[model samples]
Target: MPDLAARLRIEFHWRGGPDVVFADITEWWRDPVVLRDLPPALTALVPGPVPTVVLGPASRGTLLGALIAAHLGVGLVEVRKNDRMALHSPFHIARDLPAGYHEGGARLSFRRALVRPDDRVLCVDDWVESGGQALAIQDMVAEIGAAWLGLACVVDDLGDRAEVRARLGVRALLTAEALQAD
Candidate 1:
């Protein structure tokens, strides 16, 4: 399944261009193993009783979060892109662009009410390009007074795990190189 997904990914990159590479689960899920293996890898990154919060623009990360939550027998939360009418009292967080990437001053908002104050959260995304998005989610968790377990992604492209950890104050679980090597 991973192989098939990898093949699809390669094809996507080849035909769709580099920016269109949808390596994240929520974006391109050709198999179930991508979802299956995510939890354990995430667990290895953060040692705690943390429930996973799927960050949105809903992608493979959302599916991965649902699978992980089901596997762990925990609840799931979503960090949405737009403040819909359903999210009346939503919490907002500004995501800074990660180092080296263009398009600065981009910010994302999340609802704090979606999670409980006592909930320990592990932010899950399909991919980590800059680490800024992940860091923004972490900041939202912090603002809500919820303990953050860490950040987990199907693919981490930045390669600077230490910088992600230091800036986000949590460990990054996966890297693009690791996934490609697998």
Candidate 2:
């Protein structure tokens, strides 16, 4: 996994959408080398007291969380994003998240039964930019009386928002600038 960061940069690309430049990690997912190296790499980002259970925020996080959870020999909790299907399904939603796709309406939910008061949680995502999701997840973890260890992602794009990462205990295998390398 020594060359993982380098390989990640090489496989990473930027996709131009109608209004934005989104990162395309499809190539990373396709590379067996990356798949084999990623989980351990992300797990290493967290200092210690490895999580007993991991949390992924729907979509990408769900996939990444499963991999990393397996690496740590732990379990995963899938966090749903504003999905009506979660209503009354033992899922608790995090409130008052920062503006995003749904603005202030952004919400994150998770199954309360899956999380316990003494469990340590490490949230996994492909990328972390605004950190609103991590904060929201923290709220839900706190509500369940679980310990929120922090966030672990493939990429960290906090820019000048260093304080946010500090506040949320964010860590990543690559920085946004690392993927921009030539």
Candidate 3:
């Protein structure tokens, strides 16, 4: 795995209860020289059959997915949080929310047309912990009859959760240990 924590400056800030570490990859996302490095790094983990499409959930996943798709010369599919597309399917997701919600969860949806039966999909995310979003996305991918390539993230914060690790088999550029290091 690439030592992203060493290359990038990660800062710690208080979210609510305690300190939350954020990897400041602002330049990495903006500059091509940096972003171009990600595809090779990620594809090394999911290298076998060429994936047909890259799927990412609403928000930051879109950016990471887009870069991967472009690198692989495939299509990018955006999974939205709300009903943004005409023919969309929704799935319930529960995770650690950043306060304001006593109950933590949200509904995410994806356009049905973005995926085709024969399309091999690789799910991408900015950060993954509970694997809730990936699980929900897996259901959506199944509905479309697409082959799931596996989950990839900029950071895998799931710690030692073997269940989630076995399920998503997440390939990450950074781990919680690396990201949380001061």
TM-score, per-candidate, Cα-based: 0.68, 0.90, 0.78
Q: How accurate is candidate 1 locally (lDDT)?
A: 0.59
- lDDT of model 1, residue 135: 69
Instruction: Report per-prediction Cα RMSD to one decimal.
Output: 4.7, 2.3, 4.7
> Tens digit of lDDT per residue, candidate 3, span 1-182?
33543444333221343465444556666655457677767777875688999988877898888988999899998877545343332432222223332245666666667788898889988788778888878877887788888998877878889788778768887776765554
Show where candidate 2 strays beyond 4 Å: 17-19, 88-91, 102-105
Q: Model 2: per-residue lDDT, tens digit, 75-172?
A: 99898887776666655555556665434556678767889999999999999988888888888888888888889998999888988999889988
TM-score of 2: 0.90
Against the correct fold, how does model 1 do in TM-score?
0.68
- Evaluation by TM-score, superior candidate among 2 and 3: 2
lDDT of 2: 0.84
lDDT of 1 by residue, 64-93 (tens): 677667767777775554445333443544
1 versus 3: better TM-score goes to:
3
Write down the lDDT of every candidate, Cα atoms only: 0.59, 0.84, 0.71
